[model samples]
Target chain A: MGETFKANVIDHFNFWVAVVLMMIGLYAMITKNNLIKKLIGMSIFQTAIILFYVSAGVKDGATIPILEHHAAETEQVEAGEHVEGHPVANHEAHAINPDDYSNPLPHVLMLTAIVVGVATLGVALAVTQVIYKNYGTLEEDEILAKIKAAENDG
Target chain B: MIWQFDIIILIFLVITAVISLRVKDLLAASMVFGTYSFLICLLWAGMGAVDVAFTEATVGAGISAVILIATVYNTRRDSSD
Candidate 1:
């Protein structure tokens, strides 16, 4: 009990919260019957993936990965001042390096994921429209009933 | 304040999930789930993952919700008894 908890050094609150949400989303997906609810569950599930990717890409005390801020602020910066691509020192005392920049790769990949998600959502919504049209009802059970009735009649 | 905000956001996530599930109405569930996604995106931003936050805001909360609402509109509105 006297030992300093080494793992305590890591701030794990964010990770835990993300995980709980993820589990909730997963459970919702698995148990929900309504197709719309299932889609919502899927959204939550995708949210967990988004959180995981972002969490994985995080660095301590980092900012947005976008360089859009650099272009507008540089005019106010003096010569040899902190600027984009400027040489800076590392966190270590007297160690030479560049200012730690946020990781941009995850942002790029997430952008792709966002676009894909939207495209897929559009296609899915279109399909749902069709599913609604053919059956004259959107209830999954009703659709199944109709299919079964049709089969029996035939 | 930051820690408190994060904590509240997290608690809201769980509560909303449970409430969404408990509600018999699927539209309400989808709306609540969308709110949940929005909160999670903010939580991501708090973690300095701005890109993920943006994606979540756009895709998770936007496209997904739109699709779900479309589905709900096309399908039945209430839970089956």
Candidate 2:
């Protein structure tokens, strides 16, 4: 029981931490009305997602698949195939298996996600600025009151 | 091992829900919500859902938060209290 503690504890600890962070971020977004604080919440929420992705993508001791020309080549020296005149050694060509490489799918997906995130953030910020200009105050209640008054007057 | 991870995630989830309910400041509440999204994303990562994680990070943390905040900006600064 004692020996299995590390495996039982460490892995669970990381998972729990991520879950907690997510919960906190989500709750804040739903109930908070302050604009800046909302953005802060947004940032934290986004960061938590990033952390999850990284945690899931990491493979133990996996190397990124960068293709090296000679790396795939295998040297097969025949018993008496050596010739003094030839500068290059003759090795039979061997087929390469694609399974030995790290996965590139996640990286590609992440790149797109990152781009989309930034674009969304920019648009949201612009909208917020506009709202601030029109409402004078950024509070939800005040905006509601103003709208309510306008409705009542008309 | 798998069960442990699930349990951990579940516990955080509960805390987040409770905090969101108890907090007074709407701004603070939103911030906490965003944090919740982030935590879920990390959980996806741990589960070997790299693609899902990427999507969640952007949609959950990035876009969703922005939407809420932008909406917030349209309103009053002070809470109802």
Candidate 3:
């Protein structure tokens, strides 16, 4: 049992770390009273997820997704020798195996996610600023108490 | 991906995450959180996602940290809980 656990830990180390980080972020978001701390937690959670996706796309012994061309091939292309419409170059491109490159889909998806996360963080911080302006405190409980007091007075 | 490098970074990542949450000072927490983001960016770069790492460094570490520090400066810096 111990050996199996060790093997699993070794094989899926990245996934395990991502899960741990995610839990830490969730804990902060749930337990913290400070609004900015919660925002930081949210950012941590988002980054953990991005890490998970990017790691999932990793290929063993594979290069990045960009295709490399030999100088001879480039010179041939530039000389218009391989300009026989779509067939020749396409055939040459197809000759390269897909498995030689890491999967780019997850990376592309996470790029959008990272942008969205940043935008969300910015918006949340702005809202936090507004909250502070109105209540004069950044603590959640204080804001809640003030709101309740206002409600009781009204 | 070198396992040794990955393990070291992952360990630091978790440590930073915990410290950022546990720190009482808001500015310190924001700085630790920025460190956490930068560590994750390093992890992504090690995994061969250069573009993702670049974006994380700029947006997550740079802009997010700046915004967070600005917010912390504008508001109360101490946490009650």
Interface CA RMSD of each prediction in angstroms: 3.1, 7.6, 0.9
Sorted by TM-score (best first), the order is 3, 1, 2
Considering DockQ, where higher is better, how would the candidates rank from best to worst?
3, 1, 2
lDDT of each: 0.67, 0.59, 0.88
Give the range of the ten consecutive residues with the poorest summed lDDT in model 1 chain A: A90-99
Better of 2 and 3 by lDDT: 3
Q: What is the DockQ (computed on Cα atoms) for candidate 3?
A: 0.84
Question: What are the candidates' individual DockQ scores?
Answer: 0.54, 0.12, 0.84
lDDT of 3 at A112: 100
Q: 2 or 3: which has the higher TM-score?
A: 3
For all the candidates, what are their Cα RMSDs to the real structure? 5.4, 8.6, 3.3
Off by over 4 Å in 2: A1-5, A12-14, A72-102, B1-81
lDDT of 1: 0.67
> Residue B21 deviation, candidate 2, in Å?
16
Which portions of model 1 miss their true places by more than 4 Å?
A1-10, A66-99, B1-3
Candidate 2 TM-score to native: 0.53
Q: After best superposition, candidate 1 residue A135: deviation in angstroms?
A: 2.3
Which candidate would rank higher by TM-score, 1 or 2? 1
lDDT score at residue A136, model 3, on the 0-100 scale? 98
TM value for model 1: 0.73
Off by over 4 Å in 3: A1-3, A71-94
